[model samples]
Structure formats: structure tokens, C-alpha cells
Target chain A: MTDDTDDIKGTPALDPVISDSVELRLARQIRELDREMMPERDLWTAIERNIADYPQRKPFNLQGDWMPYGVAASLIIAIAALLVNVVGLEQRNSTLLAADYAIDSIDSGYVNVRNPMVDQFRETNKNLDQATLDDLYRNIEIMAQARKDIEMQVRANPENTKLVEMLMRVHERELELLKQDYSQPGRSL
Target chain B: MNRALKATLSGVLLAFVWAMPCYAAVDSGDLAGKRVDLSEAAKPDGFVKISIVRGDLIVEGWDKDEVSLVGTLDEKTEQFIFDVSGRDTRIIVKIPSNNTSWCCNEGSNLRIMVPKGSQVDVATVSTEVRLTDIRGGLDMSGVSGDVRIQKVSERLRVRNVSGEITVHDVDAYARIKTVSGEIDARSIKGGGAFHTVSGEIVLRDVTDEIDVESVSGDIEVIGRNISLARGHSVSGDIDLEIELIDDALVEFDSVSGSVRLRLDGKLNHKFDLETGSGSIRNRITDDKPKKSKYIRDEQLRFTVGEGDGQVNVSTRSGDISVSK
Candidate 1:
């Protein structure tokens, strides 16, 4: 529309106003611009009218509205990642605890209970607050001590089959506990 | 070309591919050049061992003056092997070379047939050992393949890793140590010792002493008539059925699996059973009475058969049941 006022043509000194040819050309360019922009302008007007009449107006002032959406999407992703990581860590911890128990109990073999692996595993996994690992370690210690005592008693009473049998029972119990620990499951982590 | 001709050509090509191995040269050197043929005059010897470097070792005992083995070593393929040499007094077989390596070119399988009274010693790695109808001691060491023996009388000793030991009709002692494999022994007339890191031990119709120690896996013993049976496992069940003779002593210990002992009424022996958190049940005969102790209110001790031989049983978290 403003281009109509700036139209100047013919002899530059002849007139301060636009000449007929220049005026016509300017008018045509303006018309073409309007023709190109009319649909977009109408669509914008319709959208503005719809938003004005919409029942649910935005609660917050929508200055830089995409900021909130981006924040929400980032929160969702963070939550999903956290959940996945937590679940994975829990599973790993579970398997690790089981394996620790098995190794401590000597379920794989005759464990000496003095094995450093047991201590190292307990110390490392204590953060998970796994009571089983501690319990297993303690039980293994007790069993090992019992085995030693029984062996001593048997040696003292070599001829006494009854005492020897009782001691043997103790030894058997120790081995059984070790096996149970091993057979249950392995460490997950 | 016609479609029929093309089809026939394809069929022939397939047949040729399949039959390639059959036509391929099977070097007898893989057999350790050890082949034993039985003679009508061959006599049963005390012991026999044949160590070969290559070729199949085929041993068949008979009534004869001497044991002869013909070696057919191929000029090619330098694979390791050991086989039978000669039968002097007993059969003494050794590897002449200092080669400490082993090979399985002929699928590494040794089929040995000895007389009913012949003893054998086999030492190989990664070769399946098959022995049948031998009456003397059978010593085997360091094998990585499956070991199968049948009707072998005398002591059988096997030490290896990752191999199954199957023995039948063993008249004497049998001791085996394996890393991870199943051990099945049946009709053993003497004591048996089995040790494994991870494996199952199954015994049937065994007499004399039976001792087995394993980290895990169930132990099933049926028709056992051993005077002393001792089994220990870290985490596995001990399932047994036998007659506890007057002089028999049976003990089984496990970590978490139940101990089920089924005994004959004729079983006359004492039992000392204990477990951490499991119950113990002992069966008594109508003829002979029994006495038990709940001494300390936790430990259970019992005596039977005039309190002769002792059978100790223990476990950590499994029940001990003695039933007829």
C-alpha cells in the first residue's frame, strides 16, 4: 500500500507525483503482494479468533511458550532414564548378592571361609545393605570354626567311633551350608 | 540340456559332496598304529598297557603265547597317539617318544577288549576310552573325553576334567576325580571314591565303601550294600536306598538339599544324624529296639544293632529322613 505513494516516473523534473506508467506498475506489484499474502493473513486471523474464543485459555503467560514444553520433555526423558538405570542397578545388585552368597557358602566347592573373596565382596556390597551377604559370611565362619573343633575332637578320640561320627556330622553340615550358598544364585553386579 | 539331465547332475553333485569324506584317506596314524588281534591260544594276563603315538588301538585278548600289535602308520600326518605294545608278564605299555602332546585325528576313540582277567591302564587326553570285560586294575589319567567301561573287575582310578565316567560291574575299588561331569557307577563290588567340582554322582547296586564329594548336584544311590558310605555336597540332595548291615556305616552331608535314606528292615546299625534347621527321622525294626537322644534339645543321636557300626548324617538346611 505504501509503495503507491512512492511511485515516480517519466521526466524526473516534470512532476513530484507519480507518472501514469509508474503508478500502474506500482499498483500491480502491490496487488500481487496482497494476492500472495492474503491466504496466510486470513489463516492467521482465523487462528487468533479461535484462540480468543477457546474455552481453555492458557494458565500462564505464553512468552517463549516452547520453553515450558522443552522443559517438560526433558523431565520425562530424565525420569525414564533414571527409572531404567535404577532397575538395572537393582537387578545387577541382586545377582551380585546371590553370587557372593554362593561363593561365600562354598556351594561351588569346599570353601575355607577364610577366602579373601568373601570379605572383599561383603565390604564392597555392604552399601547395598544386603543382610544376606553378611549373614552368609557369619554362618560360614561359624561352620568353619565348628569344623575345626570337630576335627580336633575326632583326633583326640580316634578310637571313639561315636565322637568321630558326631564330628563328621558337623563337617557335613559345614559343607552343606557352603553348597547351599553356591547353589542358590550368583552375584548380579 | 534337458531338465532331467540338470536334475541328475545336481543330484550327483550332492552325492559327491556327501561321499567325499568316505572316499577321503583315513590315515591309520591317527590310531597310534596300535592294533591287537586275539588268538585262540591267548591267555588272560595280570596287567596290560599300550601307549601309541598315532593310529587306532584295537585290543582283543585270547589264549596265546604273546600279544602282537601291527602298526600301520601313514607316512603323512604327524598327530600324537599311544597304544599297546607287548604283553610280557602283565601288559606294560608306554610312549617311546618324549611327546607330551595329544591328538584326536581318528575322532580319538580307543576301543579295548581284554580277557575277563586282564588289567588295563589307559592315559590319554581328549579321547573317548571304552573298556570291557577286564578283571584287573584299570588306571586312567588326564582324559578330556567321555570314559565308558563295562564289566571291569578290580580297582578303577580316573583323574581328569570335563569327562563323564561311566562304569558297570566293577568288582573292586573305583576312584574318580572330575572337574565338571556326571559319574555313573553300577554294580560295584568294592569301595568307590568320587570327587568333582561340579557334577552329579549316581551309583546303583554298590557294595563295600562309597565316598563322594561334590560342590553341587544331586547324588542318587540305589541298591547300595556298602559297609561304609560317606557323601558330602555343598548344595545338593543325598538320595540313597540300601541295607545298613551290622558293620555298615553310612554318612551323608548336604547344605540345603534333603537327605532321604531308605533302609531295609535287616539294616542293623547305629545312626548319628544332625542338621541345622531340618528334622531327622530314623526308622526302627520290629525285632530290634532303638534308643535316641534329643540331648541338648537340639542334637539328635540314636543307636541301633546293639550300637555297633556308626552312620553319621548331617546337613545345614535340609531334612534327614530314614524310612523302610
Candidate 2:
């Protein structure tokens, strides 16, 4: 009709074709073919049977978890540390008791013998200068401190005979100083 | 001031001065004096034994062939008896029992002179004993008075109670002991043993084997060319400065007392040192210390040079210091 399709430059032009009976005949042949199909057995019943035979799984419980094993291990370590501390303390206490007994027995006899000599020395040297007296007192204090240190060591090592002997020696030295001071001929004068 | 008042004051001052007794000069002329001489009939190498009670006793050695005794007797007591029988001579200065009670206040001061190379033995109570220029063995004991010996050339033994002992220029073995006094020994050649309780011991320039022990008293030894030395103390510090001879062995032990040792810089020795509850200061070698805990005990085992000499030191609750 009015030549609605125009030929464009540098393009190929289309050719029009008339309607044919071949299309009608092919559509009529498809309508004649079978459209319905069926399987040989029911697949829903097999799925149901397989599901019934499957094994069941258990539910999760937090009470029976692995945390108790960790707690048990920690408890064992704590008990071992405590036992070690207790044994050490007992040994230390026993040593202290033994030391105290030994020291006490020796001190009584030594003090009795030292007192009179000390008194005599003090009376004889009553006229000495204050500085000399102070120096003597200071030395005595040092000796006392040394004695205390030895006693402490003895307490830690009760069977240490050397410590006991040293303690006695310190006592004797204190008395000797008092005696020697006044025993010199010109000292009292 | 008025003349009368001045005169009165002067008189008072003179009387006061006269009333104050002189305490410096002691007079012994009032006491009796005697001397006894024995001929060479008393052997030159014989023994002289003396026993006295109170006052000073002086024994001297001379180049004589006879034994002589000069006694200063107390007017209140009997004269000393001299028995020169056999090869030994005995002198007895007798004192009354009451006079012996007072120390250094009674008894005759005997001066006995003997020949060289003569053995001498003296025993006294409450009296000072002095021996000089002796060339034989000496044995002396005293109570409550000082004992002094000088220039002895043989074995010497002295024991005392509550008195000082002083020895100088001794060239033989010596054994000295005191109970509550100081011991001062110098220039000894052949060393022996010295012990004290509650007294200080000072030994200077001693050689050969020496052993010293003390309780509650400090000990100091300073010398050179010492071959073998051992020192022990309880609650008393020990100080040693020595030059070790070849193959010398030195040991020191203490309990609650510090031990200090100074050796010659050129010494070649092996040191075995240990301390409990104490620290050690070693300036002898560069060897490291062993592992310890609690008390921090210092144990040192090391050798210097070829380790020809040995030094062992141990202490408890005290310090040990070694230096070159």
C-alpha cells in the first residue's frame, strides 16, 4: 500500500512473503499429538518410608559439658601447694621450740654468775666520766644485738651447736669487760 | 690581806698537802733483802724451780757458771729457803696463809739469776712473774698478776688466771693460756699454741706453725713468712695479715664472729671458703660464686697460679673478707 517501508542508504532491503498453508498444517499436527503422561509408581510413598527408617539425634545439655575436667585439675594443684606450706610451717615451729629451751637453760646460770661482778664494777667506777659510761653502755647494746641475732639463727636451726656456744661466749664477754675495767690498778683511782 | 691571815692560810695549805698521801712511789726498803750464790757444783744445764705466794718474781739468765738468788722478803713472813742439792736447785719464798689471800699485796719479790741454757720453772699465786734473757725451757703459772717474759730462746709454757701475759723476742715453741686477761706476744720465731677465754690475743711477727683459739675475745695476727696457721673463735672476730711461705696451709673458723684475712699479693694458693648466714668479700681471684638459697651462704673453691698453698676459712652467722 502506500510503501510504508522505505529503502535506507547503505542497507539491504527486506522482501515480503505471502501466507502459506504449511503453518496451518504444522499446528494441526501438534494438536493431534498426546499432551498427558504418567509415571510407573508413586514416589511420595517411598520418601515417607525412608523418613520413617532414619535414626534420631539427641538434644544438647549444658550440664554434662567439658568444664568439670578443667575445674578438677585446678583443685588438685591448689591442694598440693597447701600441703607443702603446712609441712614447712610445722618444721619451723619445732625448731623454734627447741632453741628456746636450750637458751633458757643456759641463760639462768650465766646471769647468776655475772650479776655480782657487774655490780662490783659499777660501784668501783662510779666516779668515771659520763662519756665513758655512755660508751660502755653503747658497746653493751651492740653485744646484746649480736646475741639476739645468734638466738634467732639458733631458732631457725635448732641443732646448730655453734650458735649456742656463740651465745654463751657473748654473755661471758659482757661480764669480762665489766671485770677488766675495774681490775686495772689505776682505773678506779 | 693581813700578814697573819696569809700565814694561817699558808699553814693550812701545807698541812693539806702533807695529809694527802703520795700514791705513786711504793717503798720496798723496809722489807728484808737477801742474796744467795751457788757455785758450778749446780750444773750449768740444770733446772731451777721456784714457788712463791704474792709480790713480784723476776728471773734472769746471765753468762755465769753459778746459780744466784736475790730475795726481798716481806718483814711479816719467813725468809726464802734455797736448796741446791743434786743437779736441780729449788727456791721457796714462803708466805703466811692470811698474806696469800690478798693479790699483789704481800710476799717477797725474789730476783733469781741463773746461767744460760738452764731450765726454769716458777709457780706463784697473787704475784707478777717476769723472766728475761733465758735460753732454756720455761714453765710458769700465776694467779691474779701479770706475767711478762722477754728474750727466751727455748720451749716456753705459761698459764694464768685473771692476769695479762706479755711475751717478746721468743725463738722457740711456746704454749700460753689465760682466763680473763689479754695476751700480747711479739717477734716469735717457732710458733706454738695460744688460748684465752674472755681476753684479747695479739700476735705480731710470728713464724712457723701457730695455733690460736679464743672465746669471746678478739684475735689479731700480723706477720710474714708464716708456714702453717690456724685460728678459731666463738663470738670473737679474727684478723690475720700474713705472707704465706712455700706450701703453707692456713685455716680459720669462727662462730658468729667476723674473719678477715690479708695475704701477700704474690701468694699462689687454693682457697676453700664457706660461710653460713653471712657474706664473703673476696679480692683474691675472679672466679664466680656457686648457687645458694635462703641463707645465701658463700662457698668459694678456686685456685691461684699452680695452687701450691692452701687457705681454708669457715664461719657461721659472720662475715669473711679476704684481700691481697
Candidate 3:
């Protein structure tokens, strides 16, 4: 039954390519290493096998030198790496958060500066002479600005027609004021 | 002998045949240079009936026997025929409508010369009616056409729909009405009632009583010399420039529109103006007390020029401005 279950020959015949790629290269590299600096996996495996031979498991009285050294080294290296990574990650995250806050503030500031009505008012005011024009130009400017602002508000709530009509009246009043101002004396073109 | 020469010959024949009738119509239908003079025609009754459908009617008084109807008709099928009937009392110009669509689609314009003090009744559809220098009463009505009368005597009544009405130099009483159009009449020697719905009414240089009402258009009057004036609007402004004569009662009201009164500062009158939360600007600058109250109190009851005229104004959701 054992012979029938065997799927391979009793001799260990292997491919030279696979042996050189994996087993031979790893074994040769381990042999070249210094004796005091042995690989940790072989030592750990031997200690586990010896401990398991006891009938009832008892705590080992002898100090395992390799175990303590390996544990202490790994613990120290991990703690140091963790501290470094935590500090680096916190710094990067805070910097990103501050940049996002600054960008948001700048975006709001730009919106205030480019308000369409205010810009048109300023352009109209430059050509106005207050003493001669009376409150005509200023009223017109304010009315135009109010209309634009109301239109912008309606973009969000489109059913608000009353506000839109009020703005239209303001625009009409501005035109009336302009026409009345044209008939005044000492008024320039 | 060649194909190109044969094609050129056919093209020449076609051009010559089509151009002959067009050139012949211009010679026969030329009215301006031709001397079709009318002898002195007399209408002793001083009455005329003008029947028009689609043409500009320009009428003036003339001392002649024949009423000259000069027009250039595009279609030979539609005759420019006018049958003048009645003896000396009355004359009627009628053109039969049984023929094809005689509407000179470029449209037609009339320059009729009636006798002095002649009455005119014109009915039109889609053409401008301009009557000037007539010493008679006018009854005009139309659909989709403008009526402009300048320097006319006797009573005037005009009814139009969907067209502008402009009457200048009206020496008698005038009553004009329109729907969805503008009314601008000026320099009236008598009072008139002008009404429009959904249209603006502007009256200037008026010397008579006026009753104007609009649904959604402004009512503006400048230089009015009337004993009583009233204007109403649904959603429009009421502007009045008054130089009131005698004791006048002026009432101006608007539902949701402004009221502006530009009156002569040298007059003496008591005025009452009311508005709902809108501002009141009194440019008259009279020596009157200014009081504040609940929704009302900005009233100026003052006297100017013996305090003969009484002015009242009211509005809702609009301002009242009184300027000198």
C-alpha cells in the first residue's frame, strides 16, 4: 500500500535550474556567513523541538540566549520604527490639513472680489460727477447691483418671482432717475 | 449651327418677352408726372364718407369738383375704381370688393382733397391713417393700424385695437380708445377722454378734461389745462404736469405703481396724497407742515393762487412724487 501511494522515485533527482535558483544558492550563502552570526529560523526551530520532547510541559529553567537577544532586538527596532513613522505621518497630515484650510479661505475671498454687480457699479461711478449727477448715478448703481444679486439668489430658488419683480422695479426707477438727470442744468454728457 | 449659339438665341427671346409688360405698366400707371388735374369741385353740405380697408389715408380740404385718388396698383386684376355719388350735400367714395385680392400688397396711400368743413368717417384694417388740416368731425376705427390726426376741428372719436394713437393739434373734443397699444396726444384745444388697456397713455399740451385708464402701462401727462382730470392704472406710473385753470378736481390712483405730479409752483390748491410704505417727494417746496402718522400723514393741504383747485392722489405699494 505504501509503494502504491508513492508518486515519485525513491532517489532525490532534481532540476539543476531550480536547485541553483533556490536551494544551492541559499545554502551556499548561509555557509559563507560567520558562525556567531547564525540565521534565527534554524535556532528557533531546534529549541521548539527539544521543549516538545518532555512528557509534561514545564517552564525551562535555563536562559535561552538566542531567544532573549532576538526578542530584545526586534522589540527595540520595532519601537524605534513606530515612533519615527508616527511622528512623520502626523506632520504630513497636519501640513495637508493647513493647506486645505488656506485654499478654502482664498476661494471665499475671490468670490467676494468678483461679485458682478459691485464691479459694474465701480465702472459706472468712475464716469459720474456727484455734484451734477445728484443721487442719480449712485441710485442706478445700487439698483443694478441689487438686481444682479437677486438674480443670483433666484438661481438657487427659482420659484421666487416676487423678489425678481422688485428688482425689475428698481431697474426701472434707475432709468427714470437717469432720464430726469439728463434734463438738469450744469450736467455733462 | 452650333449648340452654344442655339442656346443663346433661346435665352434672348425669353428675356425680351418677359420684360415688355413690366415696362408698359410703369408708363401707363405713372401718376406723379401725368397731368390728371381736377377742376374746382364744390361739396356745399360739407360732408364726405371715406371707405378704406388697407391704405394710408391723407385728407386735406381743397376747393375742387373731383376728389383726386392717386395710387399705384400692382395687380391689374384689382382696379383702382372710385364711384363718387350724391349731389352737393354729400359725396361717398366706394370701391367694389367683388374682384380678386385688390389689396395693393405693397399697400396703398391716399391723399384726398375734400371741401372745407367736411365730415370724414374712415374704416381701415392694416394701414396708417393720417388726417391733417380738416375742419370737420372725424369718426375712425380700425384693427391693427395706427391713426394719427393733426390739426382737426369739430368732435373726434377714434377706436383702434393693437395700434398706436397719436393726435396732435386737436382743436375740438376728442375721445380715443385702444387695446394693448400706446396713446400720445398733444396740443389739444379741447378736453378728451383717452383710454387703453395694457398700454401706455401719454398726453402733452392738453387744454381739456381727460379721463385716462390703463391696465399695465404708464399714464404720463404734461402741460395739462383742465378743470377735472383723473387717471388710473393697475401696475403702472401716473405722472401729471398740471397748469390747472379754474377750480379743478384731480384724482390719480394706482394699484401697484408710482404717482408723480409736476405742478406749477405758483398755484394755490389743497392736495391729499396717500401711499403704502413708499416714499413721497414733494419738489414743490411749499411752506406746509409735514406730519407723520399711520400709513397716511404725508398730506399737503395748502393754497396756491387763491386755492381754487383740489388734488387727490392714492397708491398701493408705490411712491408718490410731487415736483415743481
Per-model CA lDDT versus the true structure? 0.57, 0.72, 0.60
lDDT of 2 by residue, A58-119 (tens): 66557776588769988887787666667666677766776688776666676677678668
- Which docking category, incorrect, acceptable, medium or high, applies to candidate 3? incorrect
Pick the TM-score winner: 2
Cα error, candidate 3, residue A157 (Å): 30
- Choose 1 or 2, whichever is better by DockQ: 2
Model 2, range B1-324, lDDT digits (tens) per residue? 699999999999998765432211122333344333323336778888877656778889888857776666654444345666567877665543341233334556677888778888877655788899888788887656789999898789987656789999999988997766699999999997887766799999898889987767899998778889998776789999998986899989887789999997577889998888788888887776564865578888889878999999988778988889
Error of 2 at B201 (Å): 0.6
lDDT of 3 by residue, A1-189 (tens): 244224223437645654455556568889998889667567887787877885576677566646887889999999887777887667666655654464345435533543544445445433323322333333344444544544443343233344334434444433433332122111212
DockQ, structure candidate 1: 0.01
What lDDT score is found at residue B65 in candidate 3? 45
Best candidate according to lDDT: 2
Worst 10 residues of 1 chain B by lDDT: B94-103
Model 1 chain B, TM? 0.70
Locate the minimum summed-lDDT window of 10 residues in model 3 chain B. B90-99
Q: Name the candidate, 2 or 3, with the larger TM-score value.
A: 2
> What is residue B306's positional error in candidate 2, in angstroms?
2.5
Clash list (residue pairs), candidate 3: B40-B64, B40-B65, B41-B64, B41-B65, B191-B208, B267-B304, B268-B303, B268-B304, B268-B305, B269-B304
Span of ten consecutive residues with least summed lDDT in model 3 chain A: A180-189
